[model samples]
Target: MTSRTLPRLLQTPAVLLLLVWMLVPLGMTLFFSFIRYVLNSLRRPEWTSPSIDNWRGWGNYEYVLYSAKDFWFAVQNSLFIVGSVIALTVGLGLAIAVLVNRNFMGRGIARVMLISPFFVMPAVNAVLWINMILDPVLGLNGLAVEGINAIVASLQTMPIFGGFFSLWPEIEPVSFRATQTSAMAVIIMVTWQWTPFAVLIFMTSLQSEDQQQKEAAILDGANAWSQFRNLTLPHLARPIAIVVMIQAIFHLSLYAEIEIVSRGNGNKNLPYLIGEFASNNIGAASATGIMAVVLANIVAIFLLRIIGKSLMD
Candidate 1:
């Protein structure tokens, strides 16, 4: 065999395996999506089976798009959480990475500590932040808020500042359990966990920066802020693009963190919404699954375009 033929032969099994892995479930989802199917029904139990007679055409998609209010909300919340986390992670990560990249005592240990959060499992991270840190009644959030209130109340009882303190209302701890703020809670935990990843990437990228250019800029009497904006920021453009793409792809399908923090308690992303539909209405769920795939493809294409442009520079 030719050299290229041997490589192709070696890769054939792996390629075929991956094709089966992806296409099988995708085919099933597509088929089920176009037919009427549900987990439970007393009338016309045949509706539960997967057959051409139950063909629904675009009815499942129509139900999801038109009848379901949560679908739009889930889409909105998903984008919101993803965007927030990306902004937080990239901003905080760049700052931390720049600080940690400097030469300082115990810098090695500091780097280790900074990156430890990224190594933690997502579920564990979610639970730790939600239960140990954010729980309104028992966690630091409640305790800190309660302590402030007590201090305010005590001040109100004092003669000198009693009137002034009485005018100030007591502060309330923000609750992460409610639907309105659950997505926010998810965003916080995910950011905390993923920021370290961004830091590590940026730190590696920073090491390769042109120190000679920085020295020249210094000789030119460029201020630190100017140097950073004109030189450092441009050098980091590609790394920033890569970090954004990876984080966006990962965050778009976020599930464990959301489930642990919110449990879809009125807050849901596409994945959680899909799970909800899958519990009974398999057809709708399948249709949602297909739509999710399409959405993911759209996002992936956008990211590729951005990353490609960055790399070309």
Candidate 2:
């Protein structure tokens, strides 16, 4: 056999195995999506089992699209949370990465501390943020607001500043668990956790940047902002694209954080919607899962195009 032919033959088993591993679940999900499958059904016993007799055609998809009120909201919320997290992480990561790139005292320790947040488990991160930091009554958020109000109250007792302090209204701590703010809570915690990931990628890319080019720019009377805007940003384009793509894929299906933060109160994403459907209606859950796969693919394709363009440029 030729050398390349031999290697291809050897790799065939692994390639086939991987394909089967991915395709099997996808096939099952597709099958379930087209049928009336559920865990328990007293009205229709046959619907509980997965069989051809329970065929639903596109009924489940129709139900999800037209009947289910949360499907569209979940889709919108999922995209919102993912987009917000990506924006925050990328911006903060770029700023922190650039700041830490400079030589300074305790640089090594600072790098370690900055990257440490990425190691926190997603569930744990959510719990900590929602309970310890963002809680309206018990968390640091409430304490800080309370402290500011207290200081204002004390100032209102003073002679000259009393009138000014009286004009200031009492500040109420925000309830992050509320329907309006639950999604923001998710975004904030997720951004905190994932920013370190972006930092790591950007920092590694920045280390490989051409120092001579930077020195030349400095000698040419370019300010720090000019060097960053022209030189550093261009050099880091590929890394930024990579960070965006990977984070988009990950945050698209966020579940643990959503569950811990809101329990589907007002911040339900597609995955959480699937979970809610799965508790009883397997067919609807499977249908949602299929749609989620499609959504993820569309996002990945869009981001891939951006990556490809960055590579070409």
Candidate 3:
């Protein structure tokens, strides 16, 4: 075989596999989205199976966009969660990466401890955080508050400070399982699990920073902030953007953590909403799934452009 032909033959299987992987499910989702398919319908059982006879055109999409109560809420929540996670992980990652970049004793151990959280299963992370750390009555939050209140109560008995301490109201431990707090729980757990990933990436990028440039800046009397602003931030720009988009993609479909933390009680992102629709309304689910694809692609296009530019540089 000629070299060109041999290379094409070798690449064919992967290309075909990717095409199948991308198109087959997507095609089915598109078809189902436009048809009145569902898992259950007692009055009109014919609608239970997918058939071209029940084609819905834009009905499903309109239902999802305008009629479904959770559609906009889920979209907003998804963006909110992804945005918060990106902001937090990037900010904390920068500070931690800079602090730990320099060689120090026990640095390896520190790095291990720092990065370990990233490898944890999302469900386990959420469970451990919500149940073990954030539970109002049984977790550390409550215990810490209880301990503080105990200290204050003891202080109230002291003659010198009794009047001052007695005037303080009791503190309450926040129940993160509640409606408003559930989103906070998901955010905290996701941030804890992902910040380490950001740290690892940023730290790796920091190692490649130009030491000579930094030294020159120092000799030129550039302060730490000035050097960071002029040198490090510029160098980190692409990585920062990459990190934000990468985390955004990962968090957009966040499921296991939301399930474990809130179970869609007070918070549901887009993926979770799709899962809810998938239970009985296949048409709505498929339509929402298609919209999800569109949203992901929008973000991916911008991300790929940045990545491509970085690759060229």
Candidate 4:
């Protein structure tokens, strides 16, 4: 036997085990998606179990796509939250990475502090943000707005500026838990937690950047913006792609933050919707799970193309 044949034989068991590990659950999900499976069905007890006699075919898919009122909204909200979080994290990450790349006092402490948010558990992060930072009455948000309004009130009593200050309307603290703004709260808290991940990735990439090129650009009288645009940005292309791809995959499946922030009130993503379905209707939940898998694959493929192009460049 050839040397390569021995290696392949040794690797066979692991490859088969990995395949079984992935494919079994996937196969089960697919099977249940096509059958009328439920956790509790008193009216039709047979529907509670998985049986070929209770085949649903495309029924569950149709139910989710048309019968479920929130399916479309959940899809849209999922995309929106993912898109918003990715954009904010990338922008803020790049900014912070660049700022901290410079030599400054307490640089080590600053880096540690910046990355601390990422280590916080998702549920705890959401709780801290909603209660301590974003709460409408007791949080810093309320205090800051109240302070501004108080200052405006004090200024209105001044004779010369009384008329001008009166023109300033009292600012109300925004209720982030409300239906209209709950999604924004999810986006905000998620961005806060995940931006550090992007920062870490970009900061590492920046360190590997060729300083000789930067010095050359400086000698050529290139301004900060010019150096960033021409030299730094290109160097970070692959890293940015890596960040975006990973964040897209993760944020698409966000559940804990959504659950805690609003209990899936107006911020239901695909995963949250699946949980709602799984409470009773396993078939619908499985269907949703399959659809989520599809959506994730589509995004992964699209991002893979972009990452490939970046690597090629």
Residue-wise lDDT of candidate 3 within 31-129, one digit each (tens)?
999999989899889999899999899999999999999999999989988898899999999999989999999999999999999889887898899
Clashes of each: 0, 0, 0, 0
What is the Cα-based lDDT of residue 266 in candidate 2? Answer: 70
lDDT for 1 in candidate 4 is 100
Q: How close is candidate 4 to the true structure, as a TM-score?
A: 0.91
State the displacement of the C-alpha of residue 135, model 2, in Å, after optimal TM-score superposition: 0.6
| Pairs that clash in candidate 2 | none
| C-alpha RMSD of candidate 1 | 2.1
The TM-scores, one per candidate, come to 0.93, 0.93, 0.97, 0.91
**Model 2: residues with Cα > 4 Å off, grouped in runs:** 1-17, 302-313
What's the best-to-worst order under TM-score? 3, 1, 2, 4
Off by over 4 Å in 3: 310-313
lDDT value, residue 220 of candidate 1: 97
Tell me which residue pairs clash in candidate 1.
none
lDDT order, best first, reads: 4, 2, 3, 1
Model 1, residue 280: C-alpha shift (Å): 0.9
**Cα lDDT computed for each candidate against the true fold:** 0.90, 0.92, 0.92, 0.93
Give lDDT tens digits, candidate 1, residues 1-313: 7779988999999999999999999999999999999999899799888888999999999999999988999888888998999999999988888888889999998888888988898889889989989999999999999999999999999998799999999888999999878888998888888899999998999999999999999999999889989998999988888788788788889999888888848889999999999999999999999998988887789778876776766
Give all candidate RMSDs, comma-separated: 2.1, 2.5, 1.2, 2.7
Candidate with better TM-score, 1 vs 4: 1
